[model samples]
Target chain A: MHDYTMPFGPQHPSLKEPINLALELDGNYITGVKMRFGYVHRGVEKIFEGKDVQKVLYVAERVCGICSYAHSSACTRAMEGILGLEAPTRVKLLRTIVAELERLHSHILWAGFGLHEIGFQSMFMLFWRERERVLDILEAITGGRVHHNYNKLGSVRYDLPKGCEELMRKNIAELEENLPGLIKEFEKNSVVLARFKKVGKISRKDAITYGLVGPMARGSGVKSDIRKIDPYEAYDDIRFNEILEEGGDAYARAKVRLTELGESISIIKQCMSLLPPKPAEKWKWPPIKTGEGFGRVEAPRGEDFHYYEIEDNIVTRGKIRTPTLANIMILEKMLIGAEIGDTPVIVASFDPCIGCMERTMVIDKGKKNWFTESEFRRKFCD
Target chain B: MKRSPWISHYNASSCNGCDLEILACLTPRYDVERLGIVLRESPRHADILLVSGVVNMQNKDRLKRVYGQMAKDKYVIAIGACGISGGPFHEGWNMAGPVDKVIPVDMYVPGCPPRPESIINAIAKLLEGLE
Candidate 1:
C-alpha cells in the first residue's frame, strides 16, 4: 500500500532530449507520473518578438532539428499570407519535395528509436542505416543535412540539383523494397509485438479529449491529419491516403509512422515528376507589408502550427505549437496502469521532444548550485 | 588506446538536431562502432563524454554532475555550434553559456547538425590524439 517516487530523466538514456518525469511507483507498477518541461527552453518566441520576417524564418526552422523544413515552410507560408502572395507553382512542388523528404527521415528516425526501446538492437541499426539514404537525399537537394535553410519568402533556396531526382527515385525505390520487411518484422517479432501491442492504449474518445494530433490521433482513428483536413504547399494536388490505424496503442502509432514512410516516398516521387517546367524564382512576391496570418504544416510528428503578427514588416509576435506539446498530456492517461518497465518505451513511443515542447523563458534561482548525484543522494537520502 | 571507446552523450539545451546526428553515428552506414565507439547509457562507463547543444541555466548543474560522474581520463567532445558557443541562441536569456563554460572540452565538432561522417572524423581525430 506504499508508493515511492523515482526520477526518470533530465538526462536518462531512454530520453533523446532533456525532460524530467517524476514517477510514483507502487511495487513495480507506475501509480502516477509528473512531467517537468523547460530544460531545453531558449526563449524562442521571445527571440521572435521584433526580428525581420525573413530572418525569423531561420529562427523558426531551428525550433526542432528533425522538422526544420516543416517549420521553415510554415513560417514562409505565414509570411506569404501576410504579404498576400502566391509562390510559383514550381516553388510549391519544391517545398513539397523537401517537406515529404523531412517526413521520410523523421518517421524512419522515430521507428529506429522505437526498435531501440524494445531491445531490438539490430532493427535499430537497420532503420538508421536506411535513414542515411534519406538524409543523403536531403543533403543533395538542400545543401545541409539537419537545418536545410531551404525555404525563402516566396521560393525555395535551391532547385533539385542535376541528377538529384534520379538519386531520390533510386533511394525511394530501395526504401520501398526494404520497408515492408521492416514492418513485417515489427509485426511478427514476438518481443517487439509483446512490448508494443496495446501497451500504451488510447481510446478514440480519450485521443479526441486529449486533443492529440498527427499519428497520435490517427492511430486512434481520430482522422486528425492537418494535411488531409486542410491541404497546404503542393499537398492539394497530391494523391495519397491518410495512413490510419484503429488500434490506438503503441503498435498502432508505430504502424502509422512506418506506413507513412512509404506515403512520403510516393509523395516526393509525384512532386518530382510534376515539377512545373519553369524557374522557381519566377514566383517571386512584392515587398513585405504589415498583416497577421497563420501557417500550418504536417510535420513528421503531426500538425506543426505557427502564428505571426507583423507590424511595419517586422514580426511583432510569433507563436509555435509543436506536435509534441499537443500529445504530451496523453502520457498522463497512458501511464496510469503501465508497468514501471513500460515507462521508457511508452515515453519514447510518443516521441516527446522536450526542446520543441517547451518554449518559455524562466529564470532558475538555484542556477549557480552544482551538486553531484551522490552528494544530492547523500544529503537527501541519508 | 583501447580498440573500443565507450561514449556518454549529454544534451545541454540543444534543439535536438545534433543529438540525432550523434545517434546516426550508431547506424550501420556511418557506424562509429567499427571504430569501437559504443554509446554508453551511463556516465560512469564512458571514456568519451559527448556533449551537444548549449548549456542553459537549468541544465548546467546536471551537465556538470554528469561530467563529474565520468572517469578521470575521459575526453569531452563538444558537438555542433551551440555546444561550442551557443550557436544561434547565444544571446538567449536561458543560456548559461556553451558546454566548455561548464566543463573542459577536448574536441569541438562544428555544424548545426554535423554530418555523421564529420562526427566520425572528430572521434577518429580524438583517438589519434590519444596516441
Candidate 2:
C-alpha cells in the first residue's frame, strides 16, 4: 500500500468543533499525525485584559460552552483569592452543586457524541435524552440552560429557590434509575466492546508524564482528580469516592466518565442535604486594590486553572489553562500508530473542546503559546 | 412535497453554547427530523446554513467558504448572541463578526445559547417565511 496523506477537519462531520488533523497513512494505519488549531479562537484572555472582575466573570463563562460554569467558578475563586476573601459555607455548597450538575451534563453529552462517532445513533439519541433531564434541573436553578452565568465573586447569582429541592430529588432519582441500566447496556454491547477495548491505550506513565487531568488521567489509574487531590469549594465536605480505572484505554476513559456520573449524582444529593435554611448568600465588594491569585477547579474534562492579576478591581492580566489544552498534545503521540477508522473515536475519546483550548493559537504563523499571569502582566500591561 | 431543508452548520469561534443547542434540536426531544429538517455534513447538499459563534479572523474565510459552497437559495440563520453580534467576545481582538459582515444572514436566534425549543421556533419561522 502506498503511503498517503489525508486532511481531516477544521471542518468535518465527525468533529463537533473545528480542528484540522493531518494524517499520514500507510494503508489503514496512521504513520504520523499533525494537528492545526486556531479556527475557534475568540481571544478570551485578551478580552480579559482591562475588564473589571465582575465583567470578566461573564466573559469567562463564554470560554467553554460545555464547561462554562467551571470557568466562572474558577474566575470567581481567583478574584476572591485576590481579595483575600472566601465565600460563606452556603455559597461554597451552592457552587459545588452547580459544578457537579455541569459535570453530569458534560459527560452525558460526550457519551452521546462518542456513541454517534461509533455509529450507535440510537444510543447517542438516548444519551442526549438523558442529558435534557439534567439540563432542565440546571435551567430551573440558573435560569439559563447552557451558559449559566451563575457564579459571582463571593456568591452565586441565584440561590436555590423554593421547591428546587423536590425537582432535584426527582431528577436525581430518575438519573439514578436510568443511568445504571444505560451504562450496563453500553458495557454489554459487543460493538462498543470491540470498538473501545484496547484502542487508543495510554499507559499510566504516559498519562502522568503528559500531565493529563480529569477522566483521561483517572482512566489510566492516575490519581489526578483535582476534587480528590486538592479539594476546592465544598469538595472537602462532600463525601464521594474518586473514580479510577486501570484499563488505560479508550474503554477505561469512557468508564471513568460513566462511573463518575454516579459520583456526581451522589455529590449533588449531598449538597442538597447540606443546604442551609437561608441559602441566599452574598458578600460586599471590597475596596479596590491590587493583587494576584490562582484558582483551580476539577471541570468535567479535567483541571481548569485560572490566574489573574487584579489592579483596582480590573484584571490587567489573566491566564486560563483549560484541561483540553493540557490533554490535547498527547493526541499526537496516541494517533501515530492507530487505524485510520479509529481516528474519530480516538479524537472524540479525548473530548477535545477546541473552542475552549484555542485561546493561544495563531494558525497563520503556526505558533502555540501560553503565558503565566505574571509574565503576561510584564509583557502586556507593563 | 416540501422537502426537508438540508442544513450545514459551521462554528465560527463559538463557545459551543449555540452549537450544542443546535445538536439538541436534532435529538429525540426536539426531533427536527419530524419537521423534515436534516443536518448535512457537506455544504453542497445543504439548503440552509446554521451558523453559531462569533466570527474571528482565523475562521472568517472558512465560514465564507462554507457559505459559498451552499446552494444559491441557501438561507443563513445566525444563532445566539455571538451569531447576530459577537456577544461577550464582541470586543475581543480577534473578532471579525457578528456574522453578517462575513455572509448575508436570513434570521437571527437570540440567546447566550438559545434553548432547543427556541431553535425549533426559528426554523419553523424560517420555513413559514420561505413559503
* Candidate 2 lDDT, A1-382, residue by residue in tens: 9999999998898998999899999999999988878888877988898988899999999999999999999898888888877788888898899999999999999999998999999999999999999998998899988889898777777888888888988988999988898899889999999999999999999998999998999999999888888788999998999899999999999999999999999999898889777744345776687999999999999999999998999898899999999999899999999999999989999988988899785434225366665765575445
Candidate 2's DockQ: 0.73
> How many pairs of residues collide in model 2?
0
Over the true interface residues, superposed, what is the Cα RMSD of model 1? 6.1
Cα lDDT tens digits for candidate 1, A1-382 = 7889999888887888888889999999988889777789887876787798878988888888988888898888888898887878888898888888889888888988988887888999888888889888999999998899998887777887899878888988899999889878887999988899878999999999999999899999988888888898888999999988999889899999988887888898898889877672453545868889999988888888999999987888899999999999889878988999998788878977777888654443475445564764464324
Taking the true A–B contacts (Cα pairs closer than 8 Å), what share appears in each candidate? Answer: 0.80, 0.86
- State which candidate has the highest lDDT: 2
Provide candidate 2's TM-score on chain A.
0.94
TM-score of chain B of each: 0.96, 0.95
**Relative to the unseen true structure, what is the C-alpha lDDT of residue A26 in candidate 1, on a scale of 0 to 100?**
95
User: Residue A194 deviation, candidate 1, in Å?
Assistant: 0.6
